[model samples]
Target: MLEGKVAIITGAGGGIGRDIALLMAQQGAKVLVNDVGASLGGEGRNAGPAQSVVTEIETAGGVAAANTDSVADASNAKRIVQNALDAFGRVDIVVNNAGILRDRFFHKMSDDEWDAVLKVHLYGSYYVSRAAAEPMKAQASGAFVNMTSTSGLIGNLAQANYSAAKLGIAGLSKSIALDLDKFGVRSNCIAPFAWSRMISSIKVDSDEQAARVEKIKQMTPAKIAPLAVFLASDSARDVNGQIFAVRNNEIFLMSQPRPVRSVQRSEGWTPQSIAEHAIPALRPSFHSLDVSADVFSWDPV
Candidate 1:
């Protein structure tokens, strides 16, 4: 579906990003596979992962190249996108899938831990999207899919830093969607629940975590690739600013932060009065957890 297009995918060395890169290439899009070959928490390095994907794409008769640039840095991000342009002549799509996790409760999270996650997940998206936007603007056609997570959307314990950064990507997508319409650049986010390498390594102590992992183990990285592929296609031209959840062979349209209902003030009220009045109104609408829904069930059969 992405025939004759060129795509740049960050963190394409393994897991969801790797799956996405291969899928895009298979669909006839020339792909730039970017990854620093880091660990689950974004530590250490190996260039092998990115090269492997490139090799797979080439073996499958798809055009692909490898990039080792760190998306966490603005300068490196620019270079990553620039490499795509230099190699393929233009960038028609960008998948901002590069991320890291510093899983720790708020009180125990270190400054570096917090800063690193934020920089890679949030700022990394910003740098690459910002760099790619110009080229997309120049061409007057482009698609961007930013990878968010269920943890980011619903908030997971001990993942405050990771969640904050992921949620920030959602907000960033919305704002960029508004600004890029004039340039015909479409932006959207995918909060996937696939069991990738990162999620598989998450330390699960409590029974809750165990059950959650068991459920997620049913979903694969390959299943998450199709929505991302569609989002990067010309068919999704009007699907801008939307956040989607991909899991268990389902695709759900997720909601953003919006006012549910409001309470009117009888007078200049105190905190207790507002709290009492607002609790009932907001309780039913506020969701602590997002129930799984299958939004993408049928395809052309």
Candidate 2:
């Protein structure tokens, strides 16, 4: 579907990013696989992961190039995009799947944890998209598939930093979609539930936890790639500023943010009036503070 196109997929070392890169290449896109090759906690770095994916793509008769650059760095992000432009002479698609997990409860979360997570997921998306936007705008065509998370869309017990960054990404994508719509560029975000290195790192304690882990193992990261590929394809030209969720065999189009209820008083009400009148009027539409796990307590259908 992406024949002759050029795509830059960040975090393309392993997991969801790797799967997307391979799928995009198989669909005939020249892929620039970008991976800093960091661990799940955003520690250490290696070139093997990125290069391995590139080798697999090439061996499959697909065109791909490897880039070992950290998306967390603005200059490195620009370099990653530039690598794609230099190699393919045009930027057609960008998949901002690069991320790191510093899971910690909000109270226990350290400053470094917050900063690191935000830097990579939020700022990284901003820098890469910012660099790619100009080229895409000039070309008057492009697609962006940014990685968001249910943790952000809903909420999570731990992972305050991650949730914040993911939510920011969703907002950024929507704004980008609106800003670049005139240029014929589209932007969308996805909250993917897949078994990857990041997911596997979660500690399994009890028998129930073990069973849950096993079930998650069946939800391979590869299963999440097709949706991303489709979103970046010409077939989804009219789709923009939307959010989606992929779990096992299920794909969900999430509702965008909108006001659910409103109350008005002709005579400008005070705080007391708001608490007395408006609160009751809007109570029925008030959503519970349920996290992703709470809402999706059942197994993936």
C-alpha local distance difference test of each model: 0.88, 0.92
Which candidate achieves the best TM-score against the true structure? 2
Cα TM-score per model: 0.92, 0.96
Residue 79 accuracy (lDDT) in model 2: 95
lDDT of 1 by residue, 183-299 (tens): 899999998877788888778788966876777788888888999999999889889999998876778899888877766776866789768876777788776454232222233
Candidate 2 C-alpha lDDT tens digits along 1-301: 9998899999999999999999999999999999988888888989999999999999999999999989999899899999999998999899999998888889999999999999999999999999999999999999999999999999977889999999999999999999999999999999998998878877767897797777777788988999999999999999999999999899999987788888888999999999899999999998899978677677876
Which regions of candidate 1 are displaced past 4 Å? 272-301
lDDT of 1 at 44: 89
TM-score of 2: 0.96
Best by lDDT: 2
